[model samples]
Target: MTKKIYWAAVIYTILGLLGGLYYRELTKAKNFTGETQLAILHTHLLALGTLVFLIVLVLEKVFALSETKSFKPFFWSYHAGMVITVGGMAVHGTLTVLGKESGGAIAGIAGLGHIILTVAFVLLFAGLYARISDKQPVKAA
Candidate 1:
């Protein structure tokens, strides 16, 4: 599980770098007015997705978090939320750049993604709390 999380972080980092490059080039061309939104998507994907997974790796090691019951759900929900949220942003940004308006459906999907992210975080925190509370006190060396 820790390995999977680390790999996910690596993948998201690569994706974020690519997205940054894409945004730079697109903005340079002045063909995509919605490049800013794509940039936001890129940041969120790297920060929330990549950074969060890295944190999870640390938690797994420090707290043995992956052994908790909540780990699996937290992992799946968070990744799914990231994908949906970033995908919605990409679609919406593309449409905007094309001078097209996005309907309520796109916004709804993004909203749902955020909601899932929130739930996942709650689960993660709950698991962390459980592990922390269960920890034994450190003894002097």
Candidate 2:
């Protein structure tokens, strides 16, 4: 997870910067709808790609659940969700570049992917939190 987050941070940073530039171009072209939608996608990608992944990595390290049953599932799900979400966002971005008003399939897929990825991350976080905090010390130091 730590390694995953490190890579994600690098990729996300690049993606975010490029997305920002695209957004500026959209604004300059007076394409408000495209700008807004792509902005949402960009923000989502940036947040999940960097912040959320890092948080998960920290949680994994702090909990020391390398061999735990939930660890593998959590890791795989998060990454899989990321792939789908990112791919969908890319599709949407391409379509946006082509000047599509409705956004076609990309919009629907991106929306769905975002929802799924959000849920996957939440579940992963919850599982890690539960495993770590479920047992409390009977006595404090």
Tens-digit lDDT string for candidate 2 (17-123): 77767766766676455444556656766787777666666765666543345556666666677777767765666566566654457667766776776767666
Across residues 80-109, which tens digit of lDDT does each residue of candidate 1 receive?
988888888877776666667889999889
List of clashing residue pairs for candidate 2: none
In TM-score terms, candidate 2 sits at: 0.67
Quote the positional error of residue 114 for candidate 2 in Å.
2.6
Candidate with best lDDT: 1
Off by over 4 Å in 1: 33-36, 135-141
Output the number of the TM-score-best candidate. 1
In candidate 1 the C-alpha lDDT for residue 31 amounts to 64
- Error (Å) of candidate 1 at residue 80 is 0.5
Estimate the overall C-alpha local distance difference test score of candidate 1. Answer: 0.81
Candidate 1 TM-score over all chains jointly = 0.88
